[model samples]
Target: MTYDPTNTPAWKRLLTIETMFKEGNERDRLAREAAATAASFPRVIARYLTDAGKALGDKALAVTVTETGPRDDEGRSAFTVGNCTVCPAATTEFWETAIYGGYESDVRLTVTEAAQGAEQVVRRWAEAHATRCRELPVEG
Candidate 1:
């Protein structure tokens, strides 16, 4: 299955722009220090998804990302692959590596902990993706 961050909703794109932070002064710090550039956000997401797709293999990729849409929880939408969600937990569902940020932000999510096996892969990919995101220097 093919992956495209552009397929993500508009709301999630906005959230993705701001969700990367440590809050308080760190938000300010990131705004100033992480000034990596913004045009690459979608490219970054697409690259991460591509790499993850390869790592997990074709069958797993086909059954998950390409075949499904983000699921809604309450008023929020969650982007899922297999049984795990990978979206920001507010507004609308969109592709995101925001597995942990939802817990910190006011956004509410359905799942948090990373389990064993496949779930573990999803969890670790999110963590790594989040770290790589630090390179983007997104402006809040």
Candidate 2:
């Protein structure tokens, strides 16, 4: 039979279907673009520990970078670099490596006594993870 949609319910149904497909395609495109942008640029977190030249045994330093968008199940934005704790050795000039926990994974560097460039290493790790991680944080 020939399909006709003049003043009929099929017209509305067709319109609805079209709209759904269009919206879905647009959403996919947006997601792709967001992923590309994220891969291209790493998030920036200020270096407070090394920049200030704080002495060893001072207060522990934490460097975190929260995602700007895309909330989690708890309606909170994810942390690309979260819970990064850098503690200075009590009796040594070296700074302890940072332990970082994020939405995607947790990393603990083996370099306990990072004598030089410890802050830079931690910062680079955070920035690198921030660029690649897209998962949202989950409340645990």
Candidate 3:
């Protein structure tokens, strides 16, 4: 356990701080992520699928490499889905901002790795899922 002054008891905090600062054994890896923020969060890598026909629930799926940092400054990306009831019955419409894409959080990966992982998830999910909206047969 880290002994952050603010997070630990008065005595343990100082001791932990001394141990970390003096020995550098438990130094938190905050330096690497200092500049990272929600607004400035470099995506590193991502995968996307444009709805074009609004077939997918949300125009596209935002398959992105997940990283924890900064804060929830952006709140959350707005998302929407297409109406499936109409299918071939009538025209349907929907709007969305960002779609859900499974994240790889176990290990921090290089940009290339992140991109590959993201695309893999996007493709897998997109292929596995089915679209309810279908075109009706044209009259001969």
Candidate 4:
């Protein structure tokens, strides 16, 4: 369906939305590019973490990935990656700050709520599974 934003009374709203649409479209393009760049992070981090674990003789903390959310009101979606649960490695706020650093605009705090949730779930997992620590082979 096509949008009928033309009949709206507020000229500033229309202009602002237009500007936002233009900027958001650009940001979306950049996000896709960033995702392409980000494709290497998991493999790299996993390798590093595994190597570190092996070096320190620490048991590898297995992280499982799953889809977080496509929670959208206006057809926008956000994704997260975590240990089976949806905890983002780096958050929306981090990305926004990284992207729009020089501007004085308000930074939208999407991660505050999601990070809180992730933290709660992580806490629960640690508490519930505290007795089950996997031991690695130790070298003398």
Best-fitting candidate, scored by lDDT:
2
TM-score of each: 0.18, 0.31, 0.23, 0.28
Q: Tens digits of per-residue lDDT for model 4 on 1-140?
A: 77676666787698898999999999999889666645534321111122334456544433332223322212233333333111223222222231233124354444434433444444444433322333343457
Candidate 4 stretches greater than 4 Å from native: 1-32, 36-57, 61-109, 133-140
Residues 63-93 of candidate 3 have per-residue lDDT tens digits of 2223222223233332112212223221111
CA lDDT, every model vs. true structure: 0.35, 0.41, 0.35, 0.40
Candidate 1: tens digits of C-alpha lDDT, residues 40-124: 2212122133233455453222112211222222322234333212323111123333433433344433333211122344445
**What 10-residue stretch in candidate 2 is worst by lDDT?**
88-97
Clashing residue pairs in candidate 3 (N, C-alpha, C atoms within 3 angstroms): none
Better of 1 and 2 by lDDT: 2
Q: Provide the global lDDT of candidate 4 against the true structure.
A: 0.40
Worst 10 residues of 4 by lDDT: 84-93
How far out, in Å, is residue 50 in model 3? 14
Model 1 misplaced regions, further than 4 Å: 1-115, 135-140
**Pairs clashing in candidate 4?**
none
* lDDT, residue 118, model 4: 42
Error of 2 at 78 (Å): 6.1
